[model samples]
Structures are given as C-alpha cells and as structure tokens.
Target: MPKVSKWLRRWSLQLRWMFRYFLQWRLRHISDRQLVIGVSVLLGLGVGLVASFLLFTTRWISSLLAETPFGWLSSLYFIFPIIGILLVRTYVRFWFQGKFQKGMAYVLYGISKRQGNFEGYHRYAHVLTSAVTVGLGGSAGLEAPTVLTGASWGGFFARLFRLDSAYRVILAACGAAAGIAAVFGTPIGGVVFALEVLMANVHANFIVPLLISATASTLISRMLVEHELLTPREGLPAFDYVHLPFLVLLGILCGLIAAYFMWMSKQMTQWELREKKNGNRLFWEELFLLGALILFLPPLYGEGFEWLDAMINHHEMAYLQRSWWGHWLPAEWGIALLMFLVLMLKPLATWLTISSGGNGGAFAPTLFLGGTTGYLMAYVANHVLHFPVELPATMFTLIGMAATMAAYFHAPLTAIFMIAELSGGYHYFVPLMLITAIAYATKVIIQPVSAIQAAAQKIGAYLPADKDKAILNNISIKHVLERDCVPVPYEGSLRDLVDAIARSRRNIFPVVDKDGYLKGIILLDDVRSIIFKPALYDKVAIAELVHAPPAVVDIHESMEEVMEKFDATGAWNLPVVDEGRYRGFLSKSNILSVYRKRLRWQIEHFG
Candidate 1:
C-alpha cells in the first residue's frame, strides 16, 4: 500500500509539471481573448459529454421499471419513487452535509453571491441525485441537475487555471449553456439562455466563448446521444397565418397559467419554510402526496418529456391508454381533460417532487405545462368549439412551450430560440416571437418577479434588472466602510476636540463614550468658529456642539439601503453603528469610488 501511494504521488507531480510546461508554451503563443475561446470550446465539449451520459443513464433507469425481472413487482412501481426520494434524502443528509440545493435559483445565488465558486463535489452530486430521483419517477426534470453539473465543472476549470472572478462567472455560464445546448441540440438556444437567464450584461467579447462552447457541446452530444428533445419527425406542421387570433388567445392563456405556476411555487416555498415541517415528517408527508398524484396522473412520472412528445406528434390516444380515464371518456375529451389535469397539477407535482426530498428542477415541468396547455387549447377549439378555421395543434404545442418558458424565466429570446431549434428550422419563428412576447408581458403585469427571481429573493439573494443595483448588491457594506474617522470623547470640551482634529485629517468626528457607545457626531464645520479662539474653545462643551445625525447606518445594511439613507439625509457621510456601538463612518465618495473600480473591472474582464 505504501509503494502504491508513493507511485501515485510521483505520477501526480509529473502530471502537474507537464501541465505547467504546456501552459507556459500556450501563454507565449495565445492572446488572452484567444485563450478564453479555446477554453470555452474545451469546457463545452466536456459539459456535453457529461450531459449526454446523464441523459442516457436517466432514460435507462426510467425504462428499468417496465423491464422488471418479475412481472408482479410492476404493480409496486410507485413504491420505487419513495425509495428514490429516500435515497436522495440520505445523500443530502450524509454526503452533502445537510446542504441540499437544487434548481436554477441556487445557480443564481452562486453567481450573485459566491463569485461563481462551487464546491468540487457539485460537479458529480447533482448528476447522481437527479438521475436517481427523476429516473425512479419523482416527477421532476433532469435539466437543472445537468446544468449545475456543467457549471460546477466550469468553476473547477476556472480554479485550475487561476482565473479571476469575472472569468469564473463567465465560464460557469458557458457550462450552463453547454448543458442546455447538449440536451436539445440547440446551440443558439443555449447561448441565449446563458445570456438572458444567467448573465447580467452582454458584450461582444463574451459572445464568442459562449457560442464556441455551446456549439462544441452540441457537437459532442450529437456524437454520443441518439435522440434530442426536439428531433424533427414526419408530418410536422408549420405556422399558419389564419391561426393568428387563436395564437393571441393562447398567449394570454399561457400567461395566466404561468402566473399560477409561479404562485404555486412561491406557496410551496413558504410551506417548506415552516420550521416544524422541514424534517422527516415533511418528507414523508410530501412523499405520500406525490405518490397519490403520480398514481392518478401517470403522465406526471419523471420529466414528462415522453408525454409531451406524444402530445405534439398527434399520438394522444396511443399514449392516453396508460391513463385510467382513457377507456371511459371519448377520444377528444379524454385528451383534452387529461391535458387539462396535467396542466393544472404539474406545478403541484413539481412542488411535491422537490419538497419531498427529490432532486430536480422546474425547466422540464414548465415546458410540460406549456405543451399541455397549448394542446388542450387547440384540441378543444377545433373539436368542441367548432371554429371555422382549424387551429394547428402541433404548432400551438410548440408555441405554448416557448410562451410559458418566456413568462416563467422572463427570457423571451431564450424561449424563442429554444423552440426554433427544436423544430429543426425557423418555420415557427414569427408565432414563437409573438406568443412569447405577449405571455411574458402579461405575466410580468400580473406578477412582477419571474419564477427564478422569486426563488432567489427567498434566500436573500437579489437579482437586479438594472446594472447599477447588480454591482451594488455584490459590494457589501463592510467593503466600503471607512474606519479612519477619529472619535471624540462625549464629555470632552472643545479644547480636546481641537487637539484631536490637529492629530487627524478628517472633517467629521463621532462622539463615543468610554465603553465605545456612540452618542452623536460633531461636524468640523460646526466647530470651526471656536477653534481660533482658545479661551472660547476651552469654555465650549463638546456635548453642547454635538448634534444627532440625520440617520445612522447599521453595519449590516444592504448597499441599496445605505444609498437610500444617503439620499434621504442629504449628507455626504454617515456614522456606522452596530448594537449601539460605534464602528466607523460610511461616505458616499468611498462607495462611489469602490463602485467605479468594480465597474472598470467588469468592463475590462467582460470586454
């Protein structure tokens, strides 16, 4: 064993030396921009391979239930999901150290708060957890786990190369793009998703690496995976201008449904936050509820992509046979009613799956809901409503997917490109754009925050729309605090204050007691008149001159709140107090100076 350990250490050192030599040679030949492009391509290819493996493994496990060695066990398939959830819960409790995180909200938190730094285990944990959960029919999507795996690898690469924070974030985003691109074979969609959902600002220089990474990942996935989410099939319908009015109505309807999804998601989040229900009790309750839901809505099992495909391809009856209601209801009504149930229950199912200790994300569920809503709308309009012009159900299905995605994520471009690539062409681009825009607009009108933003807010991670707030949120109050201000004794006369001023170069002075509690502040301007008159300075009391500040800043206040205080007080500086003790002074100039430096750093790195 000692010999093997020695041999392994020797080989590791040799590999590190070789990598260092290669890096030196590459640095001499490659520009910084070229290096980023090269790394992006490699990162994308790596992410694509991992994503493809996850997809293949998930599909294999999903089909495992049907191929059970004993036929009788198939009747107990629902119990398997409970096992999956328990497995995930066990992993989270032991392996993750009780810090189980899932979904794009966590990714946003990492980007906005952690400087894109993710733990090394994240590269593989999500892949394993999500595969087991979704594969065993936990009713969640695999896309989120895939993206997190990709982003973790991206952060890993950035650390390996010792890249700066800006590059670290960009690489993380590149990984996310590669994961999405690999899943659907849509490089453009992946690129837009990274820009619209992950990144706060866009630059021409940033686009090159993103595009290269997405394309490389797509190529790798195409080589490895046999099927994509949107593989074009025969008899696929195109967009029809005659269905414009129906498309408009579908957009509004999708928007309302998306609002419901967001609301339910928020409610579930609140429920999960209840202190008493967060442990084993909550897990078992959610598990039982999820089991009941999947029993009746069999289509809710796993990611529901198969069901979505069945709907879009006009194979509703064949797929509906799996449902209990399929035999009793008429063909058209069965499809519509089943779709309606899936549409409404999808959000609840997703909540149950995630809240019950399963590992997955909302990406697939949102698409599923959109598809269901679109299919039901077109089916009912044509069969039951008897419209003069037949609505294209397939086209509506595709558009519905995009519209709901746009509203849920607040990303119209990503949605438009996602469906466009899935269709294998730009045939439905016009309708995609039209419907996504209306849906996003309508949803924003009803619910100001996107689903992702709402989740982010719960964790105290602010994702601001404007550039200024984005930078400010990243800058903590401690980073900008000025501790150089000289403190004046609360009981000291003006004589001591004058002498302290001579020792210090500051204009503002804080009146602090012997125990370090702040009493008030004395501005240098207010004491200027008595400084020249020594007799008057000795006679004047510091307590008489000290005045209460317009406002005091807490040490833990957010930068936005600090800025608001400065604005409200019309003061250039404010005293920082924590628990009635004086800490330091916070000046507008210092914050602006730090803000400028950060802005420059962003411009340099991003450009």
Candidate 2:
C-alpha cells in the first residue's frame, strides 16, 4: 500500500509538470510577431474610436458654451491668463512633491526603465487635467493627453499578459500611433510619428506593427467621426520658377524661427525646474495660475476649440478674415507684424500654459505658430522682392509647420509625415523635405537635446547611451555577490545555523564536509521546518536537513544562466564551487539589491 501511494505521488508530480510545460508553450506561441501585430491592430482600432469620440465631444461642448444665454461666455477670454498661472503652479508643486508625472518624459522612462509599465494614475491625471483645461478654453490642445492615455492602456495590457519588454515597448508605440491616426485621420503620419519621435528608430521591425496599427486606428476613427478628414485646397495657384529662390530663402528664415521656439520651450522648462527647487509653490497652485492665463488670451478664449476645428478643415483663414483686427489692420504691414509677434510669443505662451497646469498639447500651438510665420514671411517676400510665387503664403505655412516641429522635437521624419498627413497628401514633398532638413540641421547645431529630452533629464529618467544591449547581459549574480566565505558543517544544529544566517544576513547556507567540499544546501525553510521539532534540531546533522546536490555555479558564468538556474531550481541561494570545494553561496537578495541600486543610480545621474 505504501509503495502504491509513492507511485501515485510520482504520477501526480509528472502530470503537474506536463501541464505547466504546455501552458508555457502556449504563452510563448502567443508572443510571436504575428500575434503582436494582430493585437496592436485591435488596440489601435479601439483607441481610434475613443479619440474620435473625444474630439467630437470637445468641439460640441465648446459650441454649446458659446451659444449659451450668457453669450458672454465667449468673453470669458480674460479667464485663460489666470488658468495659465494655475497650470504652472500645478507643475511646480507636483515636481517638488516628488510625484512622477506623466508626459512624453514618462513615456521615455517607461521604454527605458520599467519596460513600458507606466503607472495608470499618472496617465489618468493628465487626461483629467487636459480635458478640464481645454474644456475651459485653456490655450492648449488635447493631443498629448490623448496619446498618453492610449500608451498607458497599451502598457497595462502588455503587463497583464506577461509579454516581454520588447513587445511592451512596441505596443506602447503602437498606442501612441493609434491616438495620432485617430485624431488626424492620417495613418501614415501616425506610423512615422511613432518611429521618428517616440521610438527614434525606424527599423523594419518597428515599422511593420506601427503601420498596421496606425492604418487600423485611422479607419476606425473615420467610422466614428463620420466626417471627411481635412485636406488642403486643390488647384491652388502654382509658384513660378522665378520663386524657387524665395522659397529656399523662406526655408532658412523658418529654420531660425523654429530655433527660437525650441529655445523658448527650454527656458520655460528650466524656470519651472528652478522654481520647484526653491519650494515657492506647488503643482495645484500652478493649475490656478494657468486658469487665470487662459482667461486673458483673447484668441484662445473667443473661438476656443472652434479655432482648432477651423484649422483642421482649412477654414481658419475665413475666421481670421472676419476678426476685428483683420478688418482694421493693413493686409501687408499690420497683419505681418501681428503674425510675427504672435509667432514669437506662441511658444512662450504654450510653455506658460503647460507649466502652470493647463491641460494641453504642443501640437496645436506649433501648427498655429507655423501658419502665422509662413503668412508673415510670404507677405514680406512678395511685397519686398516681388516674388512670382502664387499662393506662396500657403507653401510657407506648410513648410513652417514641418520646420518648427522638426526643430523643436528633433524629429524630421515625424514632422514631414505629420504635415503630409494633415495636408491630405498635398504634393509639397520637395519643399517640405527641404524645409524639414534645414530646420533639423539648424536645431541640431544650436541645441544638443530636444524639449522632451531636456524635461526627461530634469525629472531623473533618461535614456541610456546603448539601449539595445540586452538587460540580461548587463546584470549578473557574480557582479553583485560578496566574495566572502561562510559555511556550516553537516553536523551543525538548527539553532547554530539560524544564528549564523542572522549574523550573515543570508537566507541559505552551504553545508560542507570536513574536507571543505560542498555536501548540500540548507535553506531558511529547512530551519523553519525543524524549529518546533527541537529533538530533531539538536540530534539531526545539517546533512540530514540539507537538500542534496546543491545548485552550483562557476564564478565565470553569465548572470542570465545563473538566473535561469535559480528559477528552475526555485532556490533563493546557490553555491559557488571551484571544482569539488564550496567557495561561497550567492543569494537572490544580494542580486536584487544590486539591481535596485543600479537602477536608482541610472535615474539620478543620467536622467
């Protein structure tokens, strides 16, 4: 009967092991590239639907606010300036309080640190704040927050499914692409944006999933919005060959303007960092200040989100023509000056609005600034040089958009594709590429880091120089282990072993023979098991308590192999042996501690 019982136990163990092996095999199969692509597409579709709905809802609400009986709600323009102040206060306070906030910085951190495992709360806060700020006519856009939401969702899903780090990063990129595709209804732009800006790498491996997800998301968004995506006007007046020189000259000027925007963004972020260090205010206070600033900006307050809608639909010129300033101002001189001033001020305003805790993105502001710059430059070129370019202003506007974005973000491809998508594939590829390249080159010469990179560095989370190095190769048990010898003889008592473990701060001990050869391993569990059985504790040799055939490792083995062995054996410590003699025991606690310290150091120094 006892033999039969033993046989049953062995069979049960075998069945359990087989079941686990099958489960692991299934999981491995699911992590293949095909499955990842499918999942990304599905996620993109869902994101697109959500983004389109949000865009429509925000526009509807803005319209309703304008039409209210207190039509004076339109005059709430004065409130935006105050809101801007509050936004700054929020950023400052939160920064000082040590709460890791979400933004592009966090996205970068996730890619580098936790394998895109972002905290959900951080993302949620951004969404809530951005929505409220924009809803209240804060001079900002919702694109950043929307993208963050999608990325966070992707991160959460990847973690939940136990996907590898590489896949998680890819999924996060996919989610961001989906958000952009949905918002702009430009799948190509979305894909390129992920590669050029977020990943900063355009390898074939990333492009495949990015394109698939972006296309899917854009399709879904179109279905939800039930509106044709924006496209540039067709059959516009063409530039004469005589105007080519003027366009090239205009590109150079746009590059300079882009450099200014990038500089202003940096200064604003630096000021925020300085203020946080001084402890003058908190993040919520910045939110209040941002609210006040929103109240003061007339252009931001009167039309509100309607302006963005107009810009997207190419009806912005109509609104401008109807404005009070447009009616009184000289078409050439006054409007040109106003545009130049606004172009110079827009980046600063965006910085103030965002720093003060206003919920918004940089995308809308960049577009507005680019259009304004382009208009001003075109007017000057035509009036001063009598340039024969037809619709030179529109050409400059598109170029400005790409140039400014490329300069600020240091992402030329993303800037180019984004403009292309927004323009509905307008045939300005030659000019756009030229302007984007020049702007990128100019910015690179002027500033080594971008706004996102600078912000990330300030917040203690920066990307490593060599990110492609496998994490396994970088971390090793041998590197972390202490090179001291401590062991227990086979005859040692449980109490003795316990005392030694406490003093050594180790959970496992190597039981060695008199000749200093490793006999077996005695874990904390072994001590606990015999703790109440005092008679056995004293009488039983450590050998009797030890698990035989200690999991052993050579000093030169890779950490990856060590970890794999540790996992397979389910052991917290493994003995290090030279030949047949026990050298030391490597504890999991030590390995983990080293890894944590390294991570903390990376965050503090590099970030």
Candidate 3:
C-alpha cells in the first residue's frame, strides 16, 4: 500500500509539472482572449455531448416504461418512481455523503460564495441522479441538472488551468450557456439566460465567449441529438393586431400565477424542512403524495414536456388518458378543468419529487404551468364565453410559456427569445415582447427578487443586482488593510515619536501601552506645532500628543460598514484594532483604490 501511495504521489507531481510547462508555452504563443475563446469552444462541445446524453437517456427510459410491459401496469404507476427515488437516495447517501445539492439554486450559491468553484462530484452527480429521477416519472426537469453539470466542468477547467476568480466565474457562465443552448437548441436564448440570471453584471467581454460557447454547443447537440422538448409544431397562425388587449390581460394573469408558483414552492420547501424528522416518515408521506398527484394528473409525470407538446399540437385527450375521473367529465369543459388543476398542482409534484430525494429542476415545471395557463384562458374565452372570433389557443399557450418564465426567472429577454426559438421562428416576436415585458414588470412589483435570488439570500450568499453593492461586497476589508502604520510606545517622548515618524512613511501613528493595548492615535497635523520646537520634544510626552480618532475601525467590519464609518467620521484614516489591541490603520484612499481596481477588473479582466 505504501509503495502504491508513493507511486501515485510521484505521478501527480509529474502531471502538475507537465501542466505548468504547457501553460507557460501557451502563454508565450496565445493571448488570454484567444485562450478563453478556445476553451469556451471546447467546454461547449463537451457540455453539449453530456447534455444530449442526459436528455437521451431520460427519454429512452421513459419511452421504454410507456410501452407494453410497463404501460399495462397503470394500477402500479408508483413502482417506477419508488425504484428511481430509492436509487437516488442510496447514491446520494453513499457517494455524496447525503449532500446532494442539485439545481439552479446550488449553482447560484456556488457563484456567490465559492468563487465559482464546485465540488468534483457536481460534474457527474446531477446527470446520474436526475436521469433516473425524471426518467422514472419523478416529476421534474433535466435543465437544471444539465446546467449544474456544465458549470462544474467550467469550474473544473478553470482550476485545472489555474485561472483567476474572475475568469473562473466567466468560464462557468459560459458553461451554463453551453448547457442551455445544447438542451433547448436555443443559442441566443442560452446566452441571454447566462447574462441575465447567472452573471450579476454583464461586461462587454462576456458577449463574444458566451456567443461562441452557445453556438458550438448548439451545433454539437444538433449533430448528436435530433430532438427538441418544448418546441411547438409548424403551420401556426401569424400574430393578429386585434389580440393585443387580450394578450395584455393574459400577461397580468400570468404574473399573478408566477407569484403563486414562487410562493407555493417556498411553502413546500419549508414544510419539507420542518417535517424532516421521525425516521423516514416524511419521506413516505411525500412519496404517497407524489403517487397520488401523478396518478390523477398525468401531465405531472416526468418533465411533462410530452404533455406540453400534446397541448401545443392540440392533443386535448392526452390529459385524461390514464386518469380515474378524467373520463367522467364532458370533453369540452373537462380539458379546461384538468388544465387548471394541473397548473395548480404541478408545483406540489415538483416539490415532492425533489424533497423526496429526486434530482431535477423547476425549469420544465414553470413552462408546463405557463402553457397550461395560456391554454386554459384561450379555451375558456373562445369556447365557453363564446368570443366573437376564435382566440388562438396555440399562440396563447406559447405566450403564456414565455410570460411565466419571464416572471419567475426575472429574465424577460430569455423568455422572449427562448419561446421564439422553440417555435422555430420570430413570427410572434412582437407579442412575445409585449406580454413578457408586462409579466416581468408585474412580477417584479409584487416580488422584488427572482426565485433564484431569493434562494441565494436564504443561504446568506446572495450577490445583489445593484452594481455598487455587488462590487463593494466582493472587496474584503482584509485585502484592503494597511498594516504599515508605525506604532509608538505610550510613555515615549516626542523626540522618540519624531524619530519614529522619520523612519515610517505613513503620517498616522498608533499609540500603544506596555501591554500592547491601543491608547490613541497621533496625527501629524496635531503635532506639527510642537515638532518645530526641538527643545520641548524631550519634555513633551507622546501621551499628550495622542488623542482619540474621530472613529475607530474594528478589524472584522465589512467593507460597507468601513465605508460608512469613513463617511460619518469624515476622517482620512482610522486606526484598526482587535479586542482593544492595536493592529494597523485603514485609509479611505486605500479602500477606494482597492474598490476601483476590483470594479475595473470586473469590467475589463480579459484585457
């Protein structure tokens, strides 16, 4: 065993040395921008293949279950989910130490708290877990897991190549763009999502690499996988100008529904957390609830993309095929009733799937609800209310999908372009723009932050959307601390102080006692009068010259608090102390300098 360990250490050292040599050679030959673009392309291709595999695997398993042997066992619908969730639970317990942090929330937390660093298991854990969960009708989407897998790879490569934090985060965002583009076949939408949701601030430099990555991923995914999940069928009608007013009304409704979506999801999460005790009792309860929901609501099965596709292509009876009471109601209003029920209950199924140890994302669920909302509105208005002209249920379904996505994610552009791209063109581009804008605006007024931001805040690692707070939050006080300020003994004479001043470059001097406790500060301006009279330098004590600073800065204070202190005291520099002992001084100028450097780095890091 010792010999094997020694051999492994030797090989690791040799590999690191070779990597460093290659990095040096590459640095001499290529610019940072060129290297980043090349890496982005590679990352896109790799993430594209992985995303395709996840999609393909989940769909294949789902298809196999929907066929003869498995399909015949409709009475035992819960069997697949039982096996899938059990496998995921076992996998997570042993492999991840029961710390299976999946989805967009985990990714956002990584960006905010870990400098875009992800655990090694993140690259494959979500893919393996989510495939089983969604494949066996666990009632969630694969997009979030795919995004996390892409982000993990991005962080992995950045660390492998020894890139800075700024570059690492940007590369991670690029990976996310690649994942989305590959999954949905929407390159531009993927780029917009990365910019709007993942990255707190969008710099000019992020555009090119994000575009390149998304394009590459889309191309690779197209070559490998010739399927799409949420795209509407062809031969759809063009947008009519007369439906603008109804579209606005639909937007308002979707905004309200978006709020409900977020609220219900939060309630479910809190309930699960509160009841996470009693020796697997809560798990069984959730499993039972999930089975009941899927048994009645067929659209809640798997990612629900197939059901969404059925709605898009006008397959109304698909919602009632396997349900107990679905056949009891009339065909006309039965579809509307089921659509409404599915819209209301989908969030619960998603919560159950995830809380019961299934791995998947809410991206698909949001779209499912949105499509349901749109179809319901158009169906009721045209058929029940007997509108003069037939309102296009197909177009409304597409619009609702975009509106709810915009509201929930706070990404209007992503929703607009994503729906347009999925529908195969920008034929309804103007309607998409108008409704998404309204929905986004309404949701923002109701809830200040998006669901992702709220999740990040819950973990105490939220990066604010405000540019100033975001920049200031990243600047640590330790990094900006000036430790070069000279200290003078409390009993020392002015002559000694003058001598100390001559040796030190800083004008502020911290006075300390025999026990190393902070006495006070001695500013150069306060002693300028006595310094010229050299005869009194020996007579006057250092304690006489020292006085309390306008404000004292604690070493542990945040940069924001330090700035507030600087402003309130109106002092150029303040003494920093810890537990009444003198440490150093903090200068307003130094803090500003560091802040500027960080802000500049955020904007122009590639250069």
Candidate 4:
C-alpha cells in the first residue's frame, strides 16, 4: 500500500509538470495580444469564483460564531475578537515571515512602482487574514483583501507567462477590476474603479482588457453569490428643486467627514510607530484597546453591513441593546441615536481595524458613513425642523454613497458609476452628479491632494498614472540618444578642435581622453573666441578650456529621468555616458519627437 501511494504521488507530480510545460510552449508560440486577453478572461473568472468562495466562507463562519451555543457571550463581543486578532497577528508574524501587506494603498504601490508583481502567498494571506478579521467581528470588510487576491492572480498569470512589465501592469489592473466587479456585482463601476483608483487612468489600450475581465468576473461572481449585495433601485427619488439645498448641504458635510477619516487614518497608521519609539509594546495594547473599545460600541464591530441594512430598512437598530449599561440606558436610543453613533464611530473603528493590523478596505466604511449621514440628516429635517417638503431618505443614502466615495478618493467617475450600477439605473443622474461634484469640490478645495496621494507623497514616491509619462518611463535613453556628435580629444589644440567642430552639425562637443575616457564637455559658445583667433587657435589647448557643462545622462537612464535633468539644468542637450565612455548625446527635441510618436501609437492602437 505504501509503495502504491508513493507511485501515485510521483505520477501526479509528473502530470503537473507536463501540463505546465505545455502551457509554457503555447505561451512562447502564440501571439501576445490574443494570449493576454484570453488569459485575462480566465483570470477574471478565477478571481470572481475565489471571491465568491471567500464571501460564502466568511459569512458562514461569521454567522456560525454569532449564533452558536455560546452566542450570548458575543454580547460582550470582545472575547472572540481578542482571540481573532491575536491569532491573525501571531500567524502573520510567525508564519508569513512578519509580512502584512493587504490594502488599496499596497495594491496601488504594486501597480505604480513594482509593475504588478506580487507573491502567491499574499493572495491567500490577505484572504485568510481578512476572513478572520472581519468574519470574527473585527471592525472592517473584505473588499480590499479580495482586491489583493485578484491582483495576485493577475500578477501570477503575467509572470508565469513571462509577459512584459507593461502587460503585467495592465493585467494586474484587470485583476483588480475583476475583483471589484465580482465582489460588488458592478462591472462598470469595477472598470471605473480600476481606472480611477487602481491604475489611476483610463488608457486607450486598457479599456478592452478591463472590460473583458470585469464582465467575466462579474458573471462568475453573480452566479456564485446568487444575488446582488447592493440591489438596484426600483423607483426614482422624490427629489426636486426643493431638495437641492439640502443635497448640497449633505455633500459639504460628507466632504468634511471624508477629510476627518483621512486625517484619522493617517494618525492611526503612525500610532504604532510612535508607541514603539516611546518604548511601548503597541501590539498587545492594540488588541486590548480594541477589545475594550468594541465592547462598548457594538455597532462598530464587524463589517457593520447588517447595521447598514437595518438602517436602509428603517428597522430598530441595536446600539445600547447589548451595551454594558443596557439596563440603565433609555429606550429612546432608537434609529436616530444609532444613526448618530454610526456616523461618529464608523470612521474611528475603521481606522482602528486598518491601523491596528486588521485587514480590510475603506470602501464599506466610507459607504456606511455616507448612508448614515444622508439618512440621519433627512430624518432630522423632516422630524425636527418640520420642513414643508419631505424627501425620501433612501435617495440621499444612495447619492451620499457616491459623494463620500468621491470625496475620500477624489475619484468622481468611480463613485458615480459605482452608485449608478448599485441603483440599477440612472434615474437620479442629476442629483448624483450634483452631490458628487459638490463633495469632490469641497474636499479638493480644502485639500489639494487626495488621501492616498498624500501618503505616497510622504514616502517620497509619488506615482501619477499619466499616459505620456508611463510610456516615457518604459523607453530607454539609448533609443533616442544622438550618437552623431563628433568627439574632440581633451589634449587637442583650438585648430584641431575647430576642424572636428566643422565636421559636426551640433553646438556641443564631448571632450575625451586619448584612451576614449570622457573628461568633460566643451560648448562651442565657450571657445567661440579662441577658435576664431588665428594667432590663438594653435596656441590654445582644448584641455585648458575643458568646461563641464550641464548634467550627464547615463545609457541606462529612462527618458523620464533624462527630461528631469533637462528641466533641472535648463539645457537643450546633455552628454550620454556608458561605463565612463562618451557613448552619445541626448537632446530634448529628439526625445520629444520619439515621445509624441509613441503616444500617438498608444492612442490609435490601444483605443
């Protein structure tokens, strides 16, 4: 029996290797464009199916834990959460080599800096950690973790197939889009999110891949989940000109709250480092503090999705229902008080979950805040102020989702499209546009840069997803370098330099030694007088007038970097060096021509 088992295992390994070799053979033979799109669709389906499994598993575990024999202990709500957090940190610290990378910011960094390469371990790392974090009643959700998984899939396929860095980046983005599409069942919104938040742009070449991936993933996710998480609206809002003023007010208020969330997130993110520097063990403190804190704020525990559902349905939510002081609190702590607490505490709890090493995304938190804010604001107006006109609170909740998301990420299209897909139609397009615009404008007016951009700037590695710049970053300096510059020897006389200069068509001259080592550059302007003087032409050695001009461009430098040198030195051209040898020269004009041609190709072909 033992010999038979070993034989079976050996055959399995051989079969797997044979299959992988077959894939590699095809990857090497097929056209890249067709192969990429085909693989991307398959990857999208894989991400969506995996996301659905995670969704089911987490929800099942969460429900089982909350409704089991010892369910009453969850009223205390702090014990299992402590166990959950401890287990998560312990696993990450010991098992995963102390690496914890799961969030939107991390994904953005991978796209902009690392060209979408990610470890296979991280795909499961984020899923497992987020499952335990949010499923075991941690104050977060799974959208961001799912994104990491999707991106990992994209990276895995690209790397396995040996795709170029640019293709890897695009597919990684497609993975992210597929994840969002499947997770939210919002394909258009997912595409926009990939463009607006992940890739940070909608390039012409990217639309086809993103659409294919998102659509495929959404189909798979919809099949697995069986229903939409955010069902579209059946009817339009009762919104008219009368609601405009209040809608504007809601937008401004949501912007302020968005700013507050960003500030709190930044502060909480740094709190651990600050505590460690002060000789405090923040890990244990974070666990204990979160445990103690959630015990008092029951609404802030878990993903808070159920609580949002109750609010949307206008059901009596449980704030002080299971509170430590449940007996003493008044019964009047109903929907209004619950609404107020959610608005106030959701942001803080989200920051706690994210900063304290719990894995999740801010999407759910931002949406919750927006919904509660709009719902509560309308509730107050109708009940407290006795406004002559009353509007539907649900409309406010839906539009507020977009407004807050836009303000938080400064991605208007993503927020708007996401809400539109959620609502099932564009019946409320006017209000959606107005609310998104006002919220985004207010946030931008107060803070010129968005939260993620601000964080990137702090790290001194800001990566803007501009099309022209992205292309320039990939292009090599050698491709456009001017090798036609005639070299002049450092020891040559003015007459000898003049003879060489006459053979060249440019103003700049590279001064090299007898052994072909670059000494410096001598501009024609600097030696214009000495070259024209008949008496001094032979008397002057070019070595005496060796003036180091602007910066030198390396053969390995990217065109993006070469342009920075041009801007810094205010020079039209610079010398290029290869291992201290004078390789060639690079002019700003020559580089721009190449850039324009590439840009045109990208637009025409990609679009």
The TM-scores of all predictions, comma-separated, are: 0.88, 0.68, 0.83, 0.79
lDDT, candidate 3, at 600: 82
lDDT (CA) for every model shown? 0.83, 0.65, 0.83, 0.77
lDDT of 4 at 461: 31
Tens-place lDDT digits, model 1, residues 75-157: 35567778899998998999877887778777777776666788777788888899899889888888788888888788878
Candidate 3, after superposition: displacement of residue 534 in Å? 18
Error of 4 at 259 (Å): 1.7
lDDT tens string, model 3, 134-172?
999998888899888888888888887777776777788
Off by over 4 Å in 3: 1-18, 68-72, 231-234, 272-281, 462-465, 484-586, 601-607
Which candidate has the top score in TM-score? 1
Residue 110 displacement (Å), model 3: 2.9
Q: Give per-residue CA lDDT, model 2, range 142-192, as digits (tens).
A: 777777777776786666556666678778888888877887777887887
Off by over 4 Å in 1: 17-32, 68-75, 270-281, 382-388, 462-465, 474-480, 489-498, 511-520, 526-558, 576-583, 600-607
Winning candidate number (lDDT): 3
Candidate 2 global Cα RMSD: 12.7
Return the clash pairs for model 1, or none.
Answer: none
lDDT of 4 by residue, 1-607 (tens): 9999999999999998997897778767886666788888888889988888878777877877775332357544776676777778788889877776767766776776567888778677877888888887788778888887898889898887777777788889899898888877889988888888767655566688899999999898888775444552345455688889999999998898788778777777777678889998776676666776677667677876666555555553355565555546455435566567668777777776666677788888888778778878877777666688896777877777788989998888888888888766477788888888999998888887887677655643345366666677656776777788888998788887888788998888899999888899888888877776888888889889888868988887767678999999999889988888889888888888888887786666453
Give the range where candidate 3 is weakest over 10 consecutive residues by summed lDDT. Answer: 68-77
